[model samples]
Target: MIQQGDAIPSVAVKLVNKSGVIDGDSATIFGDGRVILFTVPGAFTPTCHNNHLPGYVSAGEALRTKGVNRIICMTVNDHHVVSAWADASEALGVVEFIADGNATLTKALGLDKDMSGGGMGTRAIRSALVIKDGIVEAVFTEDQPGQVTSSGAPAIVEFLESMPS
Candidate 1:
């Protein structure tokens, strides 16, 4: 898995918003400035709906206050699904929803966790990364998919606060 200080993989990813969809390279996204990027297994899933996504949604401005240029949430879902989920979750403008349909960024970062045995197919491990200028500054991932201790918003916020200004 990609670790702290490693440069993010140069891969393409798609994101959807009220304005429509846009595609960009991962390096371009992270290399621009500081970003708080979080991944979910699927949109509207139990934990992701109630907590994971909501956490970042609520923390969006705060993260920005701490020097984060963007707050992004991604999943192995399509543009339509992700866009709808963001609208339904009230995270539309707060947290940018990205579609990692083929696990492109997930696999490149080595954070892809298999869920096919349970019929969910392949998905990203529930995790968060702090990237600055295309380099990973910190990574937070839980031991299990359902648990969110290490990977949750609070953990990420605290980590962000601790970074040198």
Candidate 2:
């Protein structure tokens, strides 16, 4: 699994926004400035749609005040689904959505979880990373698939609050 100080892998990803989908890479997305990248098992999943994502959406400004440049919500689904989720969640302007359509980025981070038993196929484990200049500064991963204790926005805000400025 990726840890603090590890460089983010260069994997192709699709950035979904109000305009449209744009082809990009992880390096470009996370390499420039402070970023909070949170991953969900799938788009529109109950916990993700209701709890995990809404936390970030509500805390977007607070995160930015703490020096985060961009907040990215990623899922192992296609851009279309991700885009729709973004719109449905009212997160279009607040959080950027990324589509790991092939799970390339998820696998590279060693955060892939097998949900085939649930008929969801391979998906990303619920996790969050604080990255600065492409290097991981902190990682928060949930112990259970359905819980969002450590990876939630409140935890992240607390973590940032503890950091020496």
Highest lDDT among the candidates is held by which one? Answer: 2
Query: Candidate 2 residues 1-165, lDDT tens each?
Result: 999999999998999876779999899889999999999999999999999999999999999999999999999999989988988899988899999988999999999999999999999999999999999999999997689999999999999999999
The candidate maximizing TM-score is: 2
List the pairs of residues colliding in candidate 1. none
Candidate 1: stretches off by over 4 Å:
none
> How do the residues 1-165 of candidate 1 rate in per-residue lDDT, one tens digit apiece?
999999988888887765668898888877879888898899999999998888888888888888888888889998888878888998877788779999988899998988999898889998999899999998888887588788888888898788777
Q: What C-alpha lDDT values do all the predictions have? A: 0.86, 0.94
Give all TM-scores, in the order shown. Answer: 0.95, 0.98
Give the C-alpha lDDT of model 1: 0.86
